[model samples]
Target: MQFTIAEIWEHTGLFARMIIFALGAMSIASLVVMAERMLVYRKSRSESRDFAARMGAILAKDDLDAAANTRPDKNVGHLGRVINSGLTAYRVSSSSKDVAVESVARALERQAQREVQSLKRGLGVLATVGSTAPFVGLLGTTMGIVNAFNLMAAAGSGGLGTISSGIAEALITTAFGLLVAIPAVMAYNFLQGWVDARSVDISESSNEFLDMVARHFGGSHS
Candidate 1:
């Protein structure tokens, strides 16, 4: 009747055991995603800051050609990509100022979308695991309670001990499910917030780059 881990597991039914295993897998998968996402975000942030500093110097002098040709690593991530896209468009566009500005604007917009999508990669897995893990755990709990009732009936006893094992088995799964789900949901929320913040940053940076392009091209054309 006592809730001992080993004893409870030993008495756990086959269906409950399977549910535990499934929960275990979900836990592992969510942890992996969390780790990978954190690592990627950290790396991208570092590389992007460095890239911005370097690009800032080049862009300060209004050297579009130099900025376009500056090849930073792929790790430079979103900001670098957006700027590079704009520069490339500017570098190869028609001589018409309006055409060049339009081309650069389009390129920046396209690259920003692509970068945002890239940042969102693997977030769905976290969302899925967070939302479903508790329900999956509940399935185990339900099965465990059913088994408990069956055990009590087979023993022909009304004592608490007769049904205690089943109840324990049922509750454990729910506990595990919550344990798995809570962190997944929290992590998902935190990561999502970070994404939102970064998205705003990218948008602002893109608009600034666009404004600079428009100013340079507008004056020349006028």
Candidate 2:
């Protein structure tokens, strides 16, 4: 009637094993997303910081040509793209100051939206895994209990061996589910926070860029 950990898996029904395997797959997916997102956010933060420092110095001198000439660090920083878009708009627009500011503002807004979308990539997977993993485990547990009872019925006796296997299956699945879900939830929250911070930084950078344009071009804020 006694079972070791190895014996538990050996006795686990096919359906229960399938559930555990599915949970494993979900865990792997979450981990992959987490690693990928971390790398992206880290690069974005570092590049954006460097861009901000350099651009700040460039903007302080109120040099339109220099600001417009600023190049992104090999297409890393979102701020670089935003500034480039605005500057391009400013240069191509009609000589009217109002028209230039409006164009720049529109370009910056469009670029900001694109950057935010990029930052949000792969986050939905984290959310799905966090919210649904437990339910997947619960389904396994339920099926395991049912299988145990069916075995007991066929054996014509309520024996410990017949029931213990099912109980173990249920408990193992629930534990595995929690293990998978907890880290996923944590990762989702952390990454979401990182995205929010990046958004704020992008917004601040856009605002500062717009303000500089207004100051130099004699136009009100767009």
Candidate 3:
């Protein structure tokens, strides 16, 4: 007996068909998340880099007021947001140098955490799809096998056609599951690495901003 996709699909019961459709949806969702995240990260990095270069020049002059009021269009990137938070605190604090520094540090930390969490949005969906797709496929496979056995029992046949059809029905769901799962796992790992690298960039840039703040306040980076 020869099996084709259409043949196998025609033989599959309602539950197995639903499983395949669900897996297809999962694959589509993963791809959409990957594309969206990639675009967001790319835009964020470009904007942050440009903002850093411009701000670095301003901060190098030890011009706290200039940096604090440097709101260029308010379309800032991740690093810019963190740095801007510190600058906002610096601009408003009428307290002593130590108190201002503490406040600025706190602001930077809070914004950095928010930025990181924002970058990590939709990652949980990828993680869930990667970890669960296989099991979901297995569930479909189980149903397929049960249906195949029921058909065989109804026909009261132990022939080659019956056995082959049963095997095809039982295995197609598993194959579809893996097809959906593998790419999701890969995309999750790649995007996750990007987030990690961006996190490091945020941390390092936050430190640099703090140093500039301290120096402008006539203190040290420490």
In the order shown, the candidates' Cα RMSDs to the true structure are: 1.4, 2.4, 2.2
How do all models score by TM-score?
Answer: 0.95, 0.92, 0.93
Best model per TM-score: 1
Pairs with backbone N, CA or C atoms under 3 Å apart (clashes), candidate 2: none
Q: Write the per-residue lDDT of candidate 2 for residues 1-222, one digit (tens) a residue.
A: 346668888878888899999999999999999999899888877877777788778878888778777664675477777777888887787767777778889999999999999989999999999999999999999888888898899889997866886788777888889899999999999999988887887788788888877777773324
Clashing pairs in 3: none
Better of 1 and 2 by TM-score: 1
TM-score of 1: 0.95
Off by over 4 Å in 2: 1-4, 159-162, 219-222
Query: Ten residues in a row with the worst lDDT in model 1?
Result: 68-77
lDDT of each: 0.87, 0.84, 0.86
Model 3 Cα lDDT, one tens digit per residue, 64-115: 8888887764767998888888989998986577888889999999999999
Task: Evaluate residue 147 in candidate 1 and report its C-alpha lDDT on the 0 to 100 scale.
Answer: 83
Q: Per-residue alpha-carbon lDDT of model 1 for 70-106, expressed as tens digits?
A: 7756667778888888888988988887788889889
| Over 4 Å off, model 3 | 219-222
Q: Assess the local accuracy of residue 116 in candidate 1 as a C-alpha lDDT between 0 and 100.
A: 85
